[model samples]
Target: KREFITDDDSSDVTGAHVSKIESTIMVKTEASSVVLTQQQTSHLNHSQQSITTQQQQQQNVHIKQQPQQHNNIVQQAHPQQ
Candidate 1:
């Protein structure tokens, strides 16, 4: 059996003095699914330094399984310029 998965997404962040940050991640397989979520907060002395950031992520994965042979998995991610 062989499986392939790909994800491409963009995110926008809005905050003042780094009030809060949150993220979620998910992974799925034929048998089950796994998910994780995390959040963090930051306090800054100067409110004028607050700003928003935008980011984009692209990922590609390839998985292969063989009955009488070895299994193989390949994953790659694109870096921002």
Candidate 2:
């Protein structure tokens, strides 16, 4: 069997779940009737932010900090090493 999801004219929709029982495919995609709580939305936002930050950090290390002003600065900073 095959199933499809569509953007109906319903705005109060929430979760679209599908389950198989015996030889029948049950698809419940009508409406949520109840709005999602604020906690759920906040959790999603937090996860997205963390992912974005981690990606940015992995992009560059010392490429973001300022470089030495002149050769003198470099010599003064690292004399032996």
Candidate 3:
């Protein structure tokens, strides 16, 4: 009966070790997924910033052209060129 008790104790210890290994693996997988989400969010933010910059550049070009158009109109009216 003593030997049977010893065997049961060893089995319980082995079962606990297996569960610990499983939990560690689960934690590692969760951490990697979190990292992936962070990377995706940053990438999306970069794309949005680039889109806004492009829009600002376009607005600047339009503003620059308006003055040129006014100069052309003035020259046509005065025949100074």
Per-model TM-score, in order, reads: 0.13, 0.15, 0.45
Best by lDDT: 3
lDDT of 3 at 39: 35
Can you tell me which runs of candidate 1 are displaced by over 4 Å?
1-23, 28-60, 65-68, 72-81
| lDDT for each residue of candidate 3 in 32-81, tens digit (9 for 90 to 100) | 44334333443453445445544433333443455644644533643542
Winner by TM-score: 3
Per-residue lDDT for 15-77 in model 1, tens only? 422344222222122111110111111112112112311211111111212221221111122
Off by over 4 Å in 2: 1-38, 52-81
Give residue 75's error in model 2 in angstroms.
Answer: 55
Q: Is candidate 1 or candidate 2 better by TM-score?
A: 2
lDDT of each: 0.19, 0.30, 0.53
How well does model 3 score by local distance difference test?
Answer: 0.53
Q: Is candidate 2 or candidate 3 better by TM-score?
A: 3
How many clashes show up per model? Answer: 0, 0, 0
